[model samples]
Target: MNEPGGSGGAEGVRLQKVLAGAGLGSRRACEELIAQGRVQVDGEVVREQGMRVDPTTVVLHVDGMRVQLDPDLVTIALHKPKGVVSSMHDEKGRPDLSGLVADRRVFHVGRLDADSEGLLLLTNDGELAHRLAHPSYEVTKTYVVTVEGRVKPGVGQALKRGIELDDGPVRVDAYTVLETSPRRSLVQVDLHEGRNRIVRRMFDAVGHPVTRLVRTRIGPVRLGQLKPGQTRVVAGNELGALMAAVDL
Candidate 1:
């Protein structure tokens, strides 16, 4: 049921695959959403897992809401502040990253918790967002953390080796106690996994609570000198570097 010239095969493609490629979720999750009567096509609720769509002509919906496919995509980087959530809106009426950007349609490539700050990416490219956010891609994220206690000797090594997370084993790609003193320290942690609350949990596992966590880099893109609440369009080479980093 595909219209000709769609990026994925237009002739025959599974509906869940299309939704997942559109960054709604993984294919399996999309199937569950479909089963729960949450997905629709061409204004009709579609529960069939194998339903086909022609990207050129078909319209998709989820939960009675249209999911428009973006033809003109934009990607931007924002220096997110700690208080802003990484969402378009918060029902509790809290401020979110969307308040700082001019493009209202852009979605975040990945999310930072409301209390986490630093290099947050905003984009309308669903496939790119999926690639960047998925754990299998293993895009390296770099964070500078100020901890409450001085890092014990070999703590960095311990982090690099592995830490026991609630989900499973997690390890940093690179870990270093950059600056250490009697009572506090600045630690640099690099990870390919984007697990929830990973950096904070890793530090907590080591008995050093994270006082502040700011992600300085994500793959080839860096937060740089951008002040909090500032944002900029991702330029040519920088954008290319990021895509390359994710093997897009």
Candidate 2:
């Protein structure tokens, strides 16, 4: 059975997560609402911590106010440009992504380094963000890399084998050659680990240092047709496709 605004699922989800997914507020903001004795489930105020609710059955109200659940979740795919950080806002007032998102509350699914450009996911669903960013999920990402030198034989094998980094071992799930030249080669590197600068380091270790890298895909969502600095909302089965790819 499906609740009026919640998905039909048997799994138990945190009240704060549901509220945040409902776009009432961020997860932390929902917690504050709960702590203040303002949230109600089935007509009873819930001040208890870590309250779990079935999204398919619970009738939730926040701040003694009834919140009509959002019918569709918001998911945006952004083609981030180099030099712009993935953060919502920068203290230095650099061109952050917040200005590009029309909604006030949407947040990036994960962090992308300022120098790297390509697909970036933005969503209002915190639980989805948690699933996508969690290391345990091992979300696969494909990057189109331009390296400074000709890729040696077994370089791709070296990436798959693993490279030692400051954090720990970083490895690619799969990779293949795209194009090659004397000074540069473009290879597609697929990685399960989402460590910072892992792809660059992996190539550097194998003697083919990456000069420019752009993430072309995250699971099934591609940075397709989206130019740099452009944004568009995802709809229909694209949401299911993405979540399924990340095993959410």
TM-score of each: 0.70, 0.71
Q: Compared with the true structure, what per-residue lDDT tens digits does model 2 show for residues 1-248? A: 53333333545787888878876678998889889988778778878657677776676766444443446457789999999998998999888998778565788987788888999999887777888998887788889989987787788887788878777888788989999888999999888777778888778778888888899888778889999989887653466567655554
lDDT of each: 0.80, 0.78
Per-residue lDDT of candidate 1, residues 134-192 (tens digit) = 87888999999999877888888888889788899998888877898878999898888
**Top-TM-score structure, candidate number:** 2
Q: Assess the local accuracy of residue 189 in candidate 1 as a C-alpha lDDT between 0 and 100.
A: 84
Number of the top-ranking candidate, with lDDT as the measure: 1
Evaluated at residue 187, the lDDT of candidate 1 is 89
What lDDT is reached at residue 185 by model 1?
95
